[model samples]
Target: MQASRTLSRSGVAVATARPVLQFLAIMLIALVAGSTFGIWRGYDPGGYSALTFLETLQGAVGGLNVTLPLMGAGALVMTGILAVMARRDRPVAVAYAFAFVLMAVAAVITRFANQPINADVVTWTPDSMPANWTAIRDVWWHWHVVRTMLSMLGLAVLVLAIMADRNRSSAPSA
Candidate 1:
């Protein structure tokens, strides 16, 4: 009876934990991919002509068409899980909520500060690149870094939350 009960509890814990793990894994992958591109573009700002830049941007956006929805869905499911966990574990819930908030801020920064610049860049032609093209690229890189940092911070918070959950689960009950 005791062994069976322990097994049951372990199963429940795994079930609760899987979604959080999935969310963190997906976010980390996205972070790695985004950072790679951002760093490359940052160092080689003039490496691409306007047409090449636009092509690269289109390809990147096409890639995001797949990743962004997956990340967003993972985030939403994780948030829902945290919301349910809130009833039993307020601190853990709050930690997860903070993680969610950070991610939300990142998304907002991407939409408002990054997308407009992307739109402008996409419209540019090699023959008619903007006079202030450097400024636009600089601003885009700045916001991309900001959003990337926010996402990484969120991932860190989520990892902390998972650690807390593990500690709480392992501790003996009074």
Candidate 2:
């Protein structure tokens, strides 16, 4: 009976830990991918290279196209599965649960907010895009910034929940 109880408790820990880890993994992956493109294509006011800029832009678009969907789907499915398993009374579990939902929101923003801007950019010519483009770019940029920040914040919450779960697991039972 004691062994069975211990096993069941460990099972709970495993179920909770799996989703949190998956969330962190996806967030970290997105962060790395985003940072990579940012480093390669980041704005420098004094430096200008049309060729290099175009190449870096291509890399950025491609990176987003691949990583965002994969991470989004994995997070969504894992979160839904874990949500059903997590107890409502556990605050830490709830935080981790919400992280997955935040990721889904981020994905939608990327598709709706960012992709349209990217499409416009791709269709633009240097001469043609300048007309009223700044205002359009600003709105899209703001949304992108918000989505990225929210995703990072959600990932942080998931990390905290995982750490709390770990600490709880390590404590001596009464």
Candidate 3:
């Protein structure tokens, strides 16, 4: 009876953790994608050539088109789950909620600030490159730094929330 009860509790714990795991996985993907972009920005070997840099930026943005939506959706769903969990664990829920909001803010920054820069970059040709192309590229890099930090922070908070949940589940019941 004791073993069976323990197994049942374990199952419940696993079920409860599923969404958190999903959220973490999504955040990890976003972090990796953002980190790749940041590394490219830092190591841009073709910095002197506008055509090469613009081509690279175009490819990077194309990849982001897929990852960004997944990250946004993951954050939204995680926020909803955390909101429901708030009924029982308000503190952890609140922390996770705020983290997810930060993640959303990151996405907003990418869309509003970075996409416009990407759009401008995509339209540039070697012959028609603007005098301020480097300035615009610098702006894009700045916003990418902001979003990357935000996503990483969100991931850290979600990990903390997972730890809290595990501790709560394992505590001795009165």
Candidate 4:
């Protein structure tokens, strides 16, 4: 009985530590990439112009190209690891793990969907834009915005789970 209890406690320790470590690793990469891209975008020579819609699109997409890939890779890799460590019976951890999966999906959608729009924008002038370009941009950009918001919410949930686990572990023994 005592041996079983010890093993269980150790298992919890491993589970608790895994997400925090993953979060830190992923966040470090994200912060560095995000900051670097932000600087690049800020210093871009093509200041916004009504005639330069495509130029602005190129810059926006370029920034996302770097960050989204990193975020996607991190999400997919960490989620795979987290899936193994997660205890299905624990609701909070399960939810957090699911959030990682959502992030991965969002990253992929942004890559394939938004990136193509950006590619077209780079070569396109307003007059040359496809008949439905405005509609396409409106719908796709809306989805991208939602995904960004969802990612933030997901991160918050994951952090909450980590903090809850930490608190439970640090509580005085019964």
In candidate 2, what are the lDDT values of residues 41-151, reduced to their tens digit? Answer: 464212434444344445566666667667666656655555555565387568667776676677788788878877666665555555655566566657666676667
lDDT of 1 by residue, 1-174 (tens): 999999999989966786666466446535643653565556455566666666776666656634663575576556556646654778887887787787777777777887788767766667778887777877877877787787777767767876776677678999
Global CA lDDT of candidate 3, please? 0.69
lDDT of 4: 0.60
Best by TM-score: 3
Cα displacement (angstroms), candidate 1, residue 56, comes to: 3.8
My TM-score estimates for the predictions, one after another, are 0.71, 0.67, 0.75, 0.65
Which model scores highest in lDDT?
A: 3
Candidate 1 colliding pairs: none
- Residue-level lDDT of model 4, residues 1-174, one tens digit each, is 999999999988886778677676357435533443453446333343435555566666666667666655665566556555556537646765766766665666667776676677777776677776657666556656655655655565555655665565577988
Per-candidate clashes, comma-separated: 0, 0, 0, 0
Which of the predicted structures, 1 or 3, would earn the higher lDDT when compared with the native? 3
For model 3, how does the per-residue alpha-carbon lDDT over 22-89 read when each residue is reduced to its tens digit? 56645654564456456555755335577777777877777765577566666657655664665477
Q: Can you tell me which runs of candidate 2 are displaced by over 4 Å?
A: 1-59, 127-130
Instruction: Name the lDDT value of residue 170 in candidate 3.
Output: 68
RMSD of 4: 5.7
